[model samples]
Target chain A: MRGPYTLVHAEDNWQTDMGAWFSGERVVFRGKDLFTELNDFSWFKLLMFGITGKEFDDNQIKLFEAIWVLSTSYPEPRIWNNRVASLTGTARSTCVLATSAATAISEANIYGSQAELDAMYFLIQAKQAIDEGIELKSFVINHLKTFRRIGGFGRPIINHDERIAPLLNKAEELGLANGQYLKLALDVEKILLKERFRQILNVAGLAAALMADQKITLNEYHHYSVLAFSIGNISCYIDSSAQKEGRFFPLGCERLDYIGQEKRDW
Target chain B: MTKEKECITTNIWHEEAEADNPFAAKAAYCSGYDVYGELLGKVSWAEYIYLLFKLEKPQPWQSSLLESVAVAIANPGPRDLSVRAAMNGGVGGSTAASCLMAALAPGAGKNGGAREVYQVMRLWQQCGFELSQWQQHLANYQDEQAVEVWPASEHPPGFDPYGASCTTPVLQTLDHLTSLCPEEGALAYLSEHRQQLEKAADCPLAMTGVIAAAFTDLQMTEDQAEILFLLLRLPGAAAHALEQKKLGWRNYPFFGDGLTLTNDPGPAPKEDNLQGAL
Candidate 1:
């Protein structure tokens, strides 16, 4: 029963730039001492730190805080991922389970991490193309030819995205609205608007452009955005739990369009 | 702007509203079976899940096969990459859902992950028991960059890349599942041709091969096999995560020497400037 463990047998010499603990002494976070060296950092600052292993100034942190507060902290229960949290709350589930499930639901095809990542990659690559002397209009049309769907440019339900204006306002207030990637995004929006593509810059596109301006890698953006809508999710959860059992969004059989087989006696 | 869709539509599920309230469901029907009235006590959880996913009741052997594979791979231990990811969440005081998310992210990988099971399931459909087909298929695999929404194979699908030999648990699982499989069916074909299959893959058969073979015996499609593989393996991940959560990070194995900050911390950021600005 005591043969050498096959799973981690050869991982004996592993090293990480990510920090480790010192038991009761202190915790090291991204090479900074949690209590001493990084004692002044806010939770938002620490969140960015955890993602990039770098620190941010107070103003920049305030800008990120504005993004965090205004961008996707949606408290709406009807939102797909938030509904999962609401359902979990209605069922009297644990916080971790509820948030995790909701976060998992956030990986939907059109929305969530996958779409966000796609948008960021597209923005980064498009900027590279623009830098390489490709005209914006020509590049936009050519990029459209490669795939039927391009993320970060459109809202699924409404042609106009309501979040874009608020985010832009915040970015303007923070004095970061005119960054190169943000300008590119707005320029692309103009092209699409003039050409009648029926899609506008959604929150993801704006956020992606802002992130790209900061040169955040796709992986870092993904990890950083994991909890994008947690505020809304937890709010939905709280509201649902405070109400009644199994009562988030109940639907009648008559409401359902069951277009399949009929009942049969087995 | 007008909303795109109308009311929700479904082929697999319908719930009858109570006589008094349209919002309250009195009974549920799954694929036209009275789930609460007719099927709840009559069928096993395994059969119930099969009916829910496949939209039909399973034969006894099919349900049994599904249950066996599900139980076998239920938890691959905290040492498994997926399970460890979950444990990482649990030990760090992350939410339970986050632990499962941790499980799914790495668990969905092609390296001994559910995606590998999906890839292997597709290969079973393409190759069956034919070793020559497997050899050709594995040899000629290419990346077309098709851009799937969910994960596909990241590498060759069937075998373990890191192992020195076929692990004992994998062989044992294959044996147990082989007993449940039809004598001449998918599991049998796999069990008989495992050596040749290993040779073709150029690595020992991992548990994903066995699980995928068992799913093949149940006639699960590649996509179904992929998702079910994710669902079935969550139990172990959740259990380990919760256990580690209670054990605290100190009790958790942070590695033998533990993680060290090998790189020196860079200069601290200035007061009015972001550190990562280009």
Candidate 2:
């Protein structure tokens, strides 16, 4: 049967300012000669420059890089993205494929950087509500009712996330910790604890507060968080190189129980 | 006093209720018919899906094809990124939403998932209902080399990565399903020219290719095709996540045989790099 709509032709006029290739001479990244001018810059600085269309000072670069370093050490393959990376290695895939697969799978609701963006958004809204004479406890309760699960708080497997203290410490060391958002996050944590929730602000929450202080948009914050966790994913993939193909954990299969129909005639 | 409020404005708007009961609400109306009244038990889920998207119920063969497609791509095993992500999240004691998030993320990529399938469907459509036309277009595009039609990649979409022959079952399933349908549309064309296409591409017809062809034949939009693929895979991902949760938290290192603490502190930064960066 013929389709209802007929194909139409139009002149292609697509354009992009992100990056471009001009034959074999040199690549242009964000309107700058990548090989010539940007070669001396650090990868983090380059990434920031690419995203924000602005250059950063050494201190700023260090601060951002430190955030990445602090956040990139979750090498436990049980983390979703890390598991993808490890499985990629077991499949004997290339580093690019491994990292790509892992990164692709990192865009999750809670376990991924999206939680940071959501936390940032919520904190902003909470701050607004507080300014408008809403009680903090009531605001928290309302947020819980609306969102159900609070982003960037109450990590699994532990009552407190150890990374939060170090991250806050690092932010303090960098002289970038004295932000209202961080205070609000801490206050929210205090309220939750008072209410007997046992929820502490995790690294994502801390990062959200820091990013809010820096006036970073949710989009940029999410992207940066992904970049921060990328090394962990890549490292997990590399570490699993010693394992045989399709053997992530030897006992993983043993743990699985066949609960389906027992021996049936086809 | 009565003329003082002539410029009054109201903010709320209302639509007349269709159902007899004032408390009841109608969420969907299918093909000018009440969904609850006409479609609830009458149509299969696959047919309902098609009806919801295309505004018409699918043919028996189309619904059958969709059912088979869902069954075929449902579980790509635990090694698939979606399943692996769900399992990992489950092992970490994450909620079902987190697991589902991980499960959905990999569907956006070009590897054995919806994104690649959507692209292949578009490419098939662009080929314009003929095998020779597709071959000619490919040849011309290759010869020109001035503009890249597909994304800049070493391997094109609809082809598997090297050393991975994982799409066999998917293709076989597609073949079995298409055999039940009449010899027409994109599926028949693809099946007839499968050997040539594979020979030209230097790769077998991947699962994405078959799915693309099937979806195109069904006249589904790219977005609909992707959503269908994800919906089909959702149950499998949920199963994997629940199973992994049952297995409890995995404490062993991803690489070597060592039981690491769940809350193990991160490694100290290397002094040299720290100093350099600082």
Candidate 3:
């Protein structure tokens, strides 16, 4: 019998050392035994290892894991992803479907984790400009003029993100704070605040700064940030599953406003 | 001997920069037509959009359908995910673009926006524009217990979730708009099998379905149809974001205190052994 038909050129095969199942035997993950060595590591450590291909010390793990723990598990189900999960739960959908659907929705450009990646990219550029002796205020002003919005700065609902101080404090406690990216993030915030922009470094901004400090590549930065938020999507599904059927904001016929042409014969 | 690798090529751009200046003075062509001389003020925005996508100008009916769809699905208020996200972004003091981006994110889902419509169009096309064939296919899937193929419980993409009795304004508008078009086979077929389709899916046809059928009738590809839907929804998203900004920042509490509950009760207070000793 012939092997599976090949579509791509053999030389162009993508390579990976991530992980692979071995039928009934043990699994290999990042050159370690999945059931023994890798299983002993914290999920955050494992995630970081997967993305950066490097191991971290205890303090680094603590700080990184704290950021994920703090950001995960949003209480509000009204958010797009959460709402989808809730709806799925109300309809008694499977956990896999619920989480998959919700996570996909969470990828929306506006408030999704991708925004964090964009904000981080902006910060990287802004920091480079600053390193070139461009005034922070001038740099910000120019950015605002060009893009009309600076990522990782202003949020939508609150004047300040309550998550910033605590994350910063955690970073400080771990003695991992005061890196170049963190300082730059603070400087940007100060300039924006001085300009009465009312923008503060949100959790996304801080996460970007920390990830940058680790010298994570652009691709890893995006992947890690998304992985950090997966918990929230899962929690949404779990929470929604506990709810009664047809109870997730069940909209009646009256709720639908009809302003189109009145009844007409086909 | 191994063959040499084939290099990907493109006609989209030329090496000589001087040969191609899209925005150059008095020398601009959109889809190979004189934009300044022939298209300006002569073609409506809808017709221009059609020209850009199809590389040809649309018929009166096509342009009319495009314009109608664009106008109809523009805004369904702040209740929509994208609009709500935009509003939330506004309240958080996010820039207009960031808010708009949030609105666009959830639109990629099967539940809402153009993607869902595209899925419906694909299914409809697979059925060869025949209602009976589609029904039979759905029934066969049902017989095999393939709930994933067409889950009747949830709003089957392109159908309103809030029961089949209620009619969406956009769907109604689509009905009138598509009726005017010369190529009304898709719309007519949908109308003929409305009851059967609704019964099979357990929901009424939505604006997404109507738009999908209309696009099919216009002989648009799935991608083109989806893009048209996105274009139609963009203005509505912008409006919602603007309105939220105007309304000022408002707190979006996930749920009231009354609805809050603990998932675990701490192992039933350690089995009351310490309490009994106390």
Candidate 4:
């Protein structure tokens, strides 16, 4: 399938200051004792890059900024997952959708400085809005209750996300969104759903991704997709970790035997 | 609003408590729910019922709505939102919603985690040798102090304890696993690597390669394959991350750079090589 956006692959060592895409802007190291904190940030960056090929986008970066604010100034529990984890379906979904949408749209809109400037501006704005007390209509709720027949407030996995949309909608009104990427995202959503369903599009994942397209880089999207599915494995990891009293996946001689045996069965 | 907040918080706490059950809890599993196919393809009949009868996560009536959506999607006559949601992961909307978009696209390969195992296997095959030989060579290479390098004996360097190389359990497990592979070709590959494994025991990637190759030979579903991938890749990713974290490096210079074949460069690729079969 044709990627909705363009991917300009560059060779290693070219050292282009793709503007805000630069490492200094991308990698922020903040904590007490620069020497030790620098060590932790390097690891965190490695872990983050392994999960998502791209550097932390504006949302992640903004989250790190929050961490930095806490780290250097006040110090709090890692704020990124804190806020993200606390969010239920609609709000959480929208936050992910909106932020990922911004990154892709801004980058695709203009490469280099223009892209970086646009990305940073929108991100900084969204970060500020979240800091303020504004909340918007939950898009997940809107989609669930109205746009899609099966989505919304009553579903068991996501009961609390009803409040997210209002906050996001209010944020949109405050010019947190340029709206063009969202509009185009909707168009792509329509095309994808039409292909999936063999008719006009429904507000399904394809649509959500089209929405995500406006925010995340394709590689980032791939990471999101992988992580989403890996949620199942996360449960397994948690189970194994709990049993071991630490984070570990038990590897043993017998289990290894079972795996190898299965492979050669055919 | 206060009442609603209280209710939501109470419910969240209750759900968290109930999520403890591994077999029954719907709380542990998130639905990509389906509207047209199941609910828009977000929740499925089995899952909704699971939430109700098994998990009891929500109020019964409220949970029933999720099931109704699941049924609507799976109606089968026409592919509706319910069905689309069911079809989200695989077909008929039972698929996860996050996974739905990629599944809809033709070229977005179906295998995700299972393919990682296959990749490690492909890499192993690329560096040709029989699985048995590979196991022995690495075991000897790693635990040289523990045992003789390559006499045709039951106990080898990797078999005994006290090898400077830490992953002895991993190598032994792979050796046992290689014996189980169905194809003789794979067995032959194992035979070729026995000696080389003795020479370079320190290579974690090679050790990983042995474990990965052995695991790939087993029959597994896409989900199972994914579980294995995470299990194996975690060590490598963690090691890379750890180095950068501890060393305070600019990047994971060790990883992203191509892996070098330490033992033999192996022979020229032939038509019968496992790489061609894949």
Going through the candidates in order, the fraction of native interface contacts each one reproduces equals 0.51, 0.00, 0.00, 0.00
Tens digit of per-residue lDDT, candidate 4, span B161-205? 223343554445445545545455433354355445534433333
Steric clash pairs (candidate 2): none
Off by over 4 Å in 1: A1-14, B1-8, B15-28, B36-44, B59-61, B75-109, B122-155, B175-201, B234-278
Model 3 chain B is weakest, by summed lDDT over 10 consecutive residues, at B260-269
lDDT of 1 by residue, A1-266 (tens): 11235446545565766776666667777677777798988898899999988787776677766666787798889889988889889998876677878887787778888888888877877888988999999888777777865679887777877777887887788777778989988888888889888668888888888877776777778888888788888898999999988877765557788876697543
For B194-259, candidate 3 gives per-residue lDDT tens digits of 779766666566777788888887778998888777766767778777766667765453322222
> What is the lDDT for B118 in model 1?
82
* TM-score (all chains, Cα) for each model: 0.81, 0.51, 0.50, 0.26
Candidate 2's C-alpha runs over 4 A off are A1-10, A24-27, A33-39, A243-247, A252-254, B1-63, B67-278
Highest-scoring model, TM-score: 1
Q: For model 3, how does the per-residue alpha-carbon lDDT over A1-266 read when each residue is reduced to its tens digit?
A: 11123222222343446655554766666666666666778878888888787889889889878887786557467777777777877888766556656766665556666667667887788888978998888998898888788777777767778888888889999898878998888889888888887777778788788878878755676667664555666677777779777777764322333332332211
Candidate ranking (DockQ, best to worst): 1, 2, 3, 4
**Interface RMSD, one decimal, each candidate:** 5.0, 26.4, 25.8, 25.6
For candidate 3, give fnat to 2 decimals: 0.00
Q: Which candidate is the best by DockQ?
A: 1
Candidate 4 per-residue C-alpha lDDT over A184-237 given as tens digits, one digit per residue, 9 for 90 to 100: 333433443443422221222222323243455433433332222122222233
| Model 3 bad stretches (over 4 Å) | A1-8, A11-15, A32-39, A258-266, B1-278
DockQ, each predicted model:
0.29, 0.02, 0.02, 0.01
Ranking 2 against 4 by DockQ, winner: 2
